[model samples]
Target: MGKITGFMEYERLQEASEEPQKRLKHYKEFTLHLNDADAKIQGARCMDCGIPFCNNGCPVNNIIPDWNDLVFHGDYQTALDTLHSTNNFPEFTGRICPAPCEAACTLGINEDPVGIKSIEHFIIDKGWENGWVKPQPAVVKTGKKVAVVGSGPAGMAAAQQLARVGHDVTVFEKNDRVGGLLRYGIPDFKMEKSHIDLRVKQMEAEGVTFRTGVFIGKDFPADIINWAKETISADQLNKDFDAVILTGGAEQPRDLPVPGRELKGVHYAMEFLPVQNKVNAGDKVKDQIMATGKHVIVIGGGDTGSDCVGTSNRHGAESVIQFELLPQPPEEENKPLVWPYWPTKLRTSSSHEEGCERDWAVATKRLEGKNGKVEKLIAARVEWKDGKMVEVPNSEFEMKADLVLLAMGFVSPVQSVLDAFGIEKDGRGNAKATTDGEGCYRTSVDKVFAAGDMRRGQSLVVWAIREGRQCAREVDAFLMGDSVLPR
Candidate 1:
């Protein structure tokens, strides 16, 4: 540690966000970063904790203390190198990751924790500015080829690792662009797509091939246009490539199976979001789902729901309302009981702060509509007893809603892709694969491996990167009989 008592001396400082009034007009990143001196001060706040639980708290197990110390000592290059050692895409995580590491920080017990995420963001951004990021082609080739399906964080991480380890890696994305969810599902206000573009360029330089708009399974009308109509059977991949890794994300959004779900203005959050991202990338869309001039109602209260609220507001919706089926969490968590772990507490997102009428423990009973389109929501307040919800007596209500977005989260990866390859699925409908023992991450069907949300179910981007990196190691070992790649 550069400064032994620095944690005691420094207070936690967060990066300021763009003002709500100013930032609401455009879908752009507005997080103000720290200056070099300020970043060093923040880095110095890292405590000399012996165990360093923040490393374990992070999904990728980043070398937090090492980088913090390096930053504190003004060793910019070393800080960037240490940060990159664990995370292949710190820039992405630095922006969108929930920063569980802060919750695990020793200083967080009684006071604010070290600004680790901001420091990481600063280090990596500095790395790019100084031209430290570059291609690292493998010195030797293993002559093994691998096909990684999905270009999200998981797939990208796996492809990069495989390419670095001398295996020929080709990433297949079904969209017009390379990045899977990162390019489409995520809003530009959180993380700009330029970050994904630079990484794609770097991966190309590192000998990884990218095939965009390439669907591996049976091509349906919904499938993006690319490559051959002949679906690459799992058996064919086994015969051609040495190994195949499926890192495709969970795409099956949970449907509100209730009546009136077929209303014209009702749509999945994914369907509404991707269009804006595409339009930002210069792809014109017809009849885009516009929240402008409409009373928007978003269902669900997680990150995706928050994103919908933000996007809807940006669309100039007249009013936005969000509903959560669960009871409202406590304003503050009981820290002593849940230290070093994520705790359930009330968290108001930047989007929530912009504008929204939020209600908890409220369930939508049925949607009432006119002219075959959603017009109003019939809902009721719920009371919880013994972990079960019961409607409150006479608490039924109706709210005007011209547009409704379902952000209830994903159920699983699209079954079509899995069915096309005849891969087995677990009880949760995710790819059947384990992360322990021999042939870890190898799907039931030989040579075919699975990672990220496809195997673990819908999860955070940080977790996706971890799974991808680990799966890459397993695939590498399986192909070469042994691997030098880190687990």
Candidate 2:
């Protein structure tokens, strides 16, 4: 540790950002990173705890203390290297990951946690600015070839690792562009797409090929998802590639099937979020769903719901309200009881700061509409009794809602892809695959592996990267009878 008593001397500092009103006008990232001196101060706050629980808390197990010490000593290049050792895309996690590491901080039992995420953001951005990040193309070419189906974080991480190990890798994406979810599902105001594009370029230089607008499954209708422009059969991929990894996202949106569910203005959060991304990318979208001047109601209280609130505010909506079925958590967690673990506590996102009315323990009963468009929402207060929701007596209410967005989260991956390949599925409809033992990450079908959302169900981007890296190792060993890649 660079400063033995630094944790006692320094308090945590957060990254600065634009005023919500000012930032609401444009679809660009608003949060700013910490400068060098501020970052060093933050790094110095890392305590000399014997066991680094923050590492275990992080999904990728980042070498947090090593990087913190390096940053405190002004050895930022080594800090960047240490940061990249376990995580393939720190920039993505730095921006979007809900840092469980902070929750598990040793100092956080009483004091503020170290600003680890901000330090990471600074380190990676510095690496980019100094051109330290480069293509690491393998010198010796292994004859093995791999097919990674999905260009999200998991697929990208797998492809990069395998390519660096001298294996020929190709990534297939059904969308017009790469970055399956990051390209479309995410709003630009949080993270710009250029980050994904830059990585794609680097991967290409490292001998990883990307095929966009190519669906490796049965044909879908023109109205469904990114609508496969071309189809590649699973049989063809099995024959061509030595191994295949399924890293596609969970895209099956959970639907709200109450009365008047088919109203024109009511849509899934995916149906609304992706249109703005496409428009931002200079592509013309058909019949775009906008929140401008409409009274909006977003259901489900999660990151996706928060995203809807932020996007709706940006669209100049008349009003935006979000509903949560669960009871509101306490404002702060009981640290003594939940230390070194993720705790259930109230968290308000930057989007909530921008403005959105939020209510908990409220469930939508039905939607009322006129002229084939939603006009209002009918809901009621709910109470948990004996582990079940029971509506409060005579607590029914109505609110004006010109548009409704269902942000209830995904159910599973689109079943068509799994069905086309005849891969077995878990009870939850995710790809059936183990995460440990001799056959880890290998699907029931030979030479076919699954990882990320496709295998483990919907999860954070950090988990996706971890699974991708590990799956790459398994696939490598399967092809060559051994592997030097890290687990």
lDDT score for candidate 1 against the true structure: 0.90
Provide the overall lDDT of each model, using Cα atoms, as 2-decimal numbers: 0.90, 0.92
Ten residues in sequence with the least summed lDDT for candidate 2? 219-228
- Model 1, TM vs. native: 0.97
Model 2: per-residue Cα lDDT over 239-349, one tens digit each: 999999999998889889899898889899998998899999999888999999999999999999999999999999999999999999999999999999999999999
After superposition, which runs of candidate 1 have C-alpha atoms over 4 Å from their true positions?
219-231
lDDT top scorer: 2
Q: What clash pairs does model 2 have?
A: none
Q: What TM-score does each of the candidates earn?
A: 0.97, 0.99
* Cα shift from native, residue 184, model 2 (Å): 1.0
